[model samples]
Target: MEVPVMFTLQQFVDAPPSEVVRAFTEPEPFAAWFVAEGFRTPADRVRIDVRPGGQIAAVFVGDAEVPFTLHFGALDLPHHVELRFDDPAEEITVNLTELPDGRTQLDYRSVGLTDEQQAPIKPGVATMLTHLAAYFS
Candidate 1:
């Protein structure tokens, strides 16, 4: 069997699971955290059927307007969502956990992709997590 590629990132947000989930799921709210400040980017499109085989697309509104699409391969409500990105060979798994003290921990892993040409993600993710923490604080 071919093994999938993996990408890992963990972030602890001040918000509860319910609020964090909303921030991640709802387009406008999700943009506040997922996209960078002064980005002038719009969540061009974020559609989720919230079911297996659902489709999603996010187009960053910038000078380049880069876009990404994914097909939801699996989903477990308020817990995890698995999707295959534009690259069929890759899979992204996102997990969420409720921590004590009304905090939420989000763990993201991607299998089947190479970051050889891209900036390493760990530090970048940490930066984004910091943005999220501040945004939700």
Candidate 2:
């Protein structure tokens, strides 16, 4: 079997790593920042179980309501998280690093993507990260 290409993106947030982690792990902050222009999930609809083998599920309200689930592979508080999803059969790793100036550097990498799959999701991922940055601002 051929290995799929990996897509990676990095962003710097003007907040501490702990705060950044909360944005990713906590329901309210996750819903706040995980939305794009066309996709929005209310905080009440976001359910997160932050542990290895746990899951995060949300119902996105856009032109249509859609449900999404992410299975956790690993969870290291304030530093690292690994998630897997079935629709694309992808593995995503999120790494957080703290800068000396007190900002958090977010490194996001997703593996098991084909060119066709990556093309469309790339822009959405970028948009979500931009929203995340704005949430901190």
Candidate 3:
């Protein structure tokens, strides 16, 4: 059996948990910050149905247009969300914790893949998290 590879990228957003969650769950804010450097997710292609088994689908426009969809797994308002990507067969969890200073600590985790599977994804996720943090700055 192959070992499951897990990686977590954390960022401190200068906003409340609700806003941080909105940046991941809402279409407009999601499209703005949920992309890697030099890539854009078209707002028109983003469909955010925030329910279990629902989906957030969008096309990443870059050198090539890649269409991807993240299926919703579980949702705890302003706190936790679980999303699964079909092609890569990865489960992503977003956890938001409100700090004492009122900012939100966002933990984005990806699991259920091999190290090789996650190698290319880690950098893009890191870049996306940086953009998300800057969105609130």
Writing each residue's lDDT as its tens digit, candidate 2 over 57-133 gives 99889999999999999888899999998998889999999999999899999998888888888788888888787
What is the per-residue lDDT of model 1 for residues 21-137, given as tens digits with 9 covering 90 to 100?
A: 665566666566566433433544665455688766677666566666667777775777777766545676778798988888988776765565124544555566676667678
- Alpha carbon lDDT at 50, candidate 2: 90
Per the 3 Å backbone cut-off, how many clashing residue pairs does candidate 1 have? 2
lDDT of 3 by residue, 1-137 (tens): 67888999999999999888887678888888878666799788898999999999888899988888899998998899999988778999999999999999999999988888888889988888888888777
The 0-to-1 C-alpha lDDT of every candidate, in the order given, reads 0.66, 0.88, 0.87
lDDT of 3: 0.87
Task: Count the clashes in each prediction.
Answer: 2, 0, 0
- Comparing 1 and 2 by TM-score, which wins? 2
Off by over 4 Å in 2: 1-3
